[model samples]
Target: MSEPSLQHPLTGKRILVTQADAFMGPVLCEVLEEQGATVIASREDIADPDAPRRIVDQAGSVDILVANLAVPAPSSRVGDVSAGEWRDTFATMVDPLPRLMQAVLPGMREQGHGRVLVMGSASALRGMKRASTYSAARGAQMAWTQSVGVELAPENIQVNLIAQNFVDNPTYFPPEIQENPRFQERLKREVPLGRLVSAREDAQFAAYLCSDAASCFVGQVFPVCGGWVNR
Candidate 1:
């Protein structure tokens, strides 16, 4: 670990990162902690309606909530999308969102300040073949962030989403797939960055957002996809 900065942006802040073992959760937790946050890393299943509140309650007072949720993206075409896939995707990614808000908002309100950052996907930003179900769920997450971000801004609570794609992580881009020649060609043809965004780069930005410096942003969907959204 690098030496701690003289001024820790997240010093004394209590951050709760959900689904700590998945998607961007591990990196987010690692970066936030390095920045001096007391992190509550939970790897619980939040699909149950009560799980969100339970997790929040167990963590007690939270200064920031990182809604880092994910599941294996399904590539079923629109015509082949199963009802089960749709329900499960939303259940895992979308459903827990509002429940988490409800659980944490009251505590934040009492404190007069809070931050909620959703780790979402850019699949919802652009069209992709055979991603109907996964995209819709991610799209719902983006929409929810926009709506709730505005609603909570007046209360000094900031809600935002990071719509990311083509980032280097084991979940979406494992080593074997990244080493493939065809995948390299795709990177050249697609991502403007011509490479996967480093996981630390992404996590560092997330840490900044969770810090006090990001108070001006509200309900914004920042794309961190190596310019993939534009392509």
Candidate 2:
């Protein structure tokens, strides 16, 4: 194994991070910057139809695109899933991905190399209660990634995803839940790692994957759920 160092393989790389104010954006930006990357943080929600293209257009010559998309996890039962809910979830998570890729591909193709990493969810990997819409949307992201990864591999542009759950973040495991003893017990009983994966751990992994060192990984769904979704 290689010795650990503070310097990241992404040193000097120009990376564009989407949804920069939410989800895993802040931490991802922090870690990527710490590793010497010049991060272009886009605070746009990306729900607007033309936002993806505009964002990519705004950031020209990007070496990496971190599609860090996120929305509130829907708790409506599969039977109670409404058309509006389904459409909205897909709109929030799935639709923008292709647009973003298409917009950025030309520049990456020009450069002859690039990386696209999707910040996704583990709920898509397994059946979860009352998360049908959210899981389906996330699954769509992964499925699109799988097809695109192979398509872009010839251009030396890597597309991949990090399907994660049960991590220490403000979105899912908020302060109130973390303070609950029951939640802590459940965390220990459920996750094999026996705790929430730190934000830095997850962010660092993302940084490495976006780096040149992770070129071998393509269209791969790496679970960062601390063994929560072992399958």
Candidate 3:
């Protein structure tokens, strides 16, 4: 195990954060930079099959890959889920995992140390109404992380995931939704924390996972949803 710096554990580390404009991408990049890491933020639309590889190629080598992939979750019930919607959801969230891994793994292997963190959703960890398509895609991400995390562990590349929900992000719980009384009641009733996990809090945890101190963690699905998954 390496002794990581307390204040700047990510110093000297070059990290690539995908979908830099959405989901947890913005905050993750901000916190990682504050931790002294060189963040290669990519805002590329990865729906095109070649985009993931292109993004990686453009960024060159990186010590970490933060797959911050997301889309506006579809709210169709299970019976109403259309094939196009299902495929699009997976295209955005699930398909890019392997593509990004394929692009980045070789460099990581050469370096003999790397980290991959997927900013996923707790909707996959727990059941949600009208979220079948989204949850299925997120579930695939978690399973892929578990499998690849172990496979790459021996090579010193740690792969893990943060299954998060009820986090303060513009995508899911924007200010307008947060200010609603009904949503506030739902938060109090459903979430054990009685509030959305702040963006900084979630980003800080992500920083830890990307740090040298987190090398031992592999194939782990860490829930950062204000205890919503457990409850």
Predicted model with the maximum TM-score: 3
Better candidate by TM-score, 1 or 2 = 1
Tens-digit per-residue lDDT, 30-74, candidate 1: 999888999999989989899999999999999999999898999
Over 1-231, each residue of candidate 3 has an lDDT whose tens digit, in order, gives 333478989888999999999998899999999998999999999888999999999999899999999999999989999999999989999999999999999999998888999999888877889999999999999999999999989999999999998999988888899999999998988888899999999999999999888889999999888775244
TM per model? Answer: 0.95, 0.94, 0.96
In model 3, pairs of residues that clash are: none
TM-score attained by model 2: 0.94
**What local lDDT does model 3 show for residue 162?**
94
Point out the worst 10-residue segment of candidate 1 by lDDT: 1-10
**Tens digits of per-residue lDDT for model 2 on 1-231?**
243355757776889999898889999999998988889999987989899999988887789999999888889988899999999888889999989988998899888999999999888888888999999999998899899998889889899999998878777888998999999998888888888899999999999898777899888898888776244
Q: How far out, in Å, is residue 122 in model 1?
A: 0.9
Per-candidate Cα lDDT values, in order, are 0.92, 0.88, 0.92
User: Which run of 10 residues does model 3 get worst, by summed lDDT?
Assistant: 1-10
Worst 10 residues of 2 by lDDT: 1-10
Off by over 4 Å in 3: 1-4, 229-231
